[model samples]
Target: MTPDSPASIRPAELAGLDLLASAVVLVDSGGHIVYVNAAAENLLESSLKALARQQLAALFAMPQELEHIVAQAREHKFSDVRQELALERAGREALHVHIIASAMDRPDGAVLIELREIVQQMKQDREERLLDQSQVNKELIRNLAHEIKNPLGGIRGAAQLLEMELPPLHLTQLREYTQVIIKEADRLQTLVDRLLAPHRRPHIVGDVNIHEVLERVRSLILAEFPLGLTIRRDYDASLPEFRGDKEQLIQAVLNIAHNAAHALAARIEQGDAEIVFRTRVARQMTLAKVRYQLALDLHIIDNGPGIPSQIRDRIFYPLVSGRDGGSGLGLTLAQTFVQQHMGVIECESRPGLTDFRILLPLP
Candidate 1:
């Protein structure tokens, strides 16, 4: 192995890089690609063999900026970090990426380049914020539920007593007013119970088939919207089962699908409503700051008017709803359920497409 030869770094040593969620590329002093990790292949939409000996800067729209960073790393033997760089591919959309270039110890002045998608970084940051905010929101809701629960019972009892004390026949007409009060109290009580349900329910863990959960949700959704709505399935049959609460997962998915159905009301009336349930195996996925070798990527997508942008960011927060008269607990409870299983749910929406993606780690 000559000191000037980077060929001394065998493929076996680079195998570890494949496990990383971040894209990595190794460039020799001449700014030619020597090695590319699996994540890099996915990001560049090319294979390692195809990229071997290719100029690293050629893959990016701003080649001169990339080349300058690589040169600086090689000359100073220091690391350089740049943000919001565009990586262009022939048949795909340009990627906004954050690039990190660091000089390696090789005698040939080989440098290590790491690429992270800006959108993905922002998504991860949002997930972390959602998780933290959810904890505080749950606590507030639980306390509020308890407070409301006590008064609800009292209000219902008082209303019942007032009805009983009403005059026999003529005042029976006045009993209707008391009945309304009692009924509204009971309704509020039910809402309070649901607010505290997640904290009160026991997590029943067992081997769960994600497809089964999806099928159950599909049936329930179709049963409700039998005529106009269509539920499509795109299943990856190779996905493995993992430990979780099957019932909780079903309810979680059903809640999201149900919301989509309601959001698609206009299309449903026109007999064009469509909701797709897609399942795929994700490799080297990071969920809740932990990187997993494999994970389940489940998407519930609907072709509707899309979520109103005003409340899109807070959809998972308790009582935040985009639709009129919506209690807003569905997505919040779905997020709580997924979080219990160490998973996270993210959403993307536009004028015609709304997608809710749930990521769950698989053992």
Candidate 2:
């Protein structure tokens, strides 16, 4: 065969294959790396050219299970196996990766191994678990609402009766106290209604232009807090309309943007508050453990004091709030509404910057 012929080409040709986002390494019989692909460079945090002649064991310190798998692959003509290995990348903590090994038929007696970061797998697992937990909570809330609503009405009625019996001067104070209780009970009822709204109403699935949602939210924010605040829109015009529950999605986006506006109060007072509503199309996204070709990416970013460190971790939990006079149910309801449409909401916050990203599958 000629030097340029495919059959006579070097083993590096494996790099040209359209592999998944996995680290691929080609190692010879003695376990010296003959070739490494771009994915491997990212996973291992080392350049492929620099690692060409390095021994695999020296570079990876593979786990016993992975080493055993590789050994078996060497003994057998071809073997495919999966195992987890802990690898330390430069300037990063040690990460666990799932390694899949298979023997190759190259004349150099090389084996091809693919590695995928276990962290991404774990994130998928966690997202599924959280979705299940949220579903359970929704059922509990529905049941509890049914159980509480009847007694709540009776209590409010009894309060009214007692106020009517009191003396004129004392009646005013008594009614004031009763009013507070009734007001609070009514507020709880509203919350319960909001929680049940999505399930009770038919999903109005339609071709939703995401930019319209952002525009409506921006106008509302500007109207409410026009002074010392700026609203920016960074939308991708090429994005297509997505099939989604329009009202529910509007509420979800509004809740997040409202929370950001509240956080920017001090910044607004200082005339430096900025809230950005950005939209894009994510090429590949896994929502609720299911992968899709394209998904809507909406970001609500604010240059505020950021979320409080104390409640940052539990921001999505019901009745958790960092601001005074905040209902704390906005985000919880927002999350519930989005999840109903098979989406996920994620938050990343630090001092002076807080971002809430929502991912919804496209039709």
Candidate 3:
């Protein structure tokens, strides 16, 4: 149907069409919502009649990027598809939305915009990027393990052999130098082993209950840091089993929980440390470009001095850590393992609370 024929269409037909679809809103050049479909009403949690003549910006906190999208649509008659944006719904829940807008062919100058939840889209994007990076990481790890590790082993052996041939006084200094080489070689070898572990190990896929993994991590953390710490679980019993490598999932969850435990040390000592493991089922989840009806949502939350701002962005990168004694491989390994199961890991942190979210597709 032509956009200009709004007057010719019956109100029932328009409302019915909107209710059957996702979210649809028609706004004038002045940013006023001239017409909102039933889906838009439900999505915004506002009635269509009430939304009429109200400024679109008044309904939600529009991100600068989304404002730019609206501006472009008005200025250049731009149309967008699958443009990711964030919106705060009426109930104050921050929603990730994909905004599609097109200039409506009307003399009154209106734009038709559609909103779809973009959490799934973002998950799929992350999964695809991680999977691609995983393949490259696998190759790099294999090459380094074979090429550098083999030569380093030979060098360490040669150092030990040469150390036995030195004179008494010279032997002490020679042994010291040889020991340094061997120690450094050993450290490198350990690093190589970590890098190749995921690829070298066979994935034993099974029905994994996320709660079991969380509980195991909780016990381990409490045992190590048996102070004033509290661990809580908030799991949705209705969540279905997901197919994954059990050992890998355990390691992945443990790594994140361990990081939280470390972050909570001060709070734990003060008897205020709280770490929560929450699980939910996400509907209409999309991972690696494929959509599914259900996905697992696992959140690891901690109340502590939050992650440092400087290292926050690179927390998932290898060798990056916020703590002094941390190996910096926990989050990296956690991310790697989750990605292998076609999942996405994300973090949100502030001064008091830090949350790590793991989204995995369920069978």
Candidate 4:
């Protein structure tokens, strides 16, 4: 339909489509597009007007099979029929989606198709599992920290006492070894304290503007990587302030940014390191198996040699590290802080791109 056509969809109807989170595409019996919702436009990477001129077969992997399914649904007056299908889009990888097709009870015999990517379902499952594992890890680390703390104290005290008792002749060389023992024991003591800190620390809640937190981290990161790193800000100015611990949020973002900077050392040296801090309001978001009506979606992305795939799955686990000499506690601590605020952090990485996303409830 042309812009001047009276048969064109009214603005009120288009506004209704914009409210839907699911990708909804309306197709007529003759296999032509009649209407495509905002979500559908994004999923299909085409404007509604553009989609209206395209054939339905141009979007799916096996058009003939979908045509057959639609025919059976229409003949039987079936509604809410779902099928797993793949979408075929030019110059892009085919998306594996679960499609729900409902034959509208209209004379035009239109079909409403809703698409949800299968990978998103898998990621939801992974997020739930990761949260449960994080809880288990916290318990294990607490118990282990206590158990390790007592022995460390004994070793440090014994070493100090032995150092004091050493004779003058042999004291110098032996005292050096005792100093090493004391230093290592002190380091382990510090590690254990950090492992238990979150559990013991009091929660300080207040209204937090996410941008403010990002600014704090930005200043800190830029100060350290002053020469060769660029930290880009892509924040949503209209984001509402939410209640959370400002200090914890700062630490959480700082840890992730610091880790990204560490991973970008080579790129930084070559003067091409880039990190992006992005924020957006997500509607109808699900995190850790719990659905929220609205949420804060924050992404920390880096352009560096990405994380190793071998250890990618275990990156959030305590004490796991890809870089040599890394404590591997940065991400773990970051996850802990965000979890305390009823949020979740997830990572996706590959060669040349590494992204960490944080999702939290919004008012």
Candidate that scores best on TM-score: 1
1 versus 4: better lDDT goes to:
1
Q: State the C-alpha lDDT per candidate.
A: 0.90, 0.79, 0.78, 0.86
* Residue 164 Cα positional deviation in candidate 1, in Å, after optimal superposition: 5.5
Better structure of 1 and 4 per TM-score: 1
Return the clash pairs for model 1, or none. Answer: none
TM-score against native, each model: 0.89, 0.75, 0.71, 0.76
Better of 1 and 3 by TM-score: 1
Candidate 1 per-residue C-alpha lDDT over 1-363 given as tens digits, one digit per residue, 9 for 90 to 100: 553344767878788999898999998877888888999999888887888788989988989999999888888746575646899867878988999998887778888999999988888888888888989999999999999999889999999998888879856789889989999998899899999999999999999999999999998989999988999999999999999999999999999999999999999999999999999998888888889888999999999999888888888888888888999999999999999998889999998999999999999
**Residue runs of model 3 more than 4 Å from their true location after superposition:** 1-42, 46-113, 116-147, 167-177
Query: What global local distance difference test value does model 1 have?
Result: 0.90
Q: CA shift at 363, candidate 2, in angstroms?
A: 3.1
Clashes of 2: 0
Which of 1 and 3 is the better model by lDDT? 1
| lDDT per residue as tens, model 2, 1-363 | 432223443656674643444578877766767677766886777886788667676655554555677888866735587777777666767788888889876665567888888887777777787788778877887787778877878877887787778899787777889888788878777876765665688878888888888888888889999999999889989889878877888888888888888888888899999998888898557798776768988888999888888998778777788888887778888998888888998888999889998888887
Candidate 4 residue-wise lDDT, 285-330, digit = tens: 7766666778999999999888888899998888998888988888
lDDT of 3 by residue, 215-319 (tens): 888889899988899998898999877788988999998999888888888888799899999999876556655656679989999998889999886788777
RMSD (CA, Å), each prediction = 2.6, 5.6, 6.5, 5.4
Tell me the spans in candidate 1 whose CA falls farther than 4 Å from its real position.
Answer: 1-4, 10-15, 77-79, 91-93, 160-177
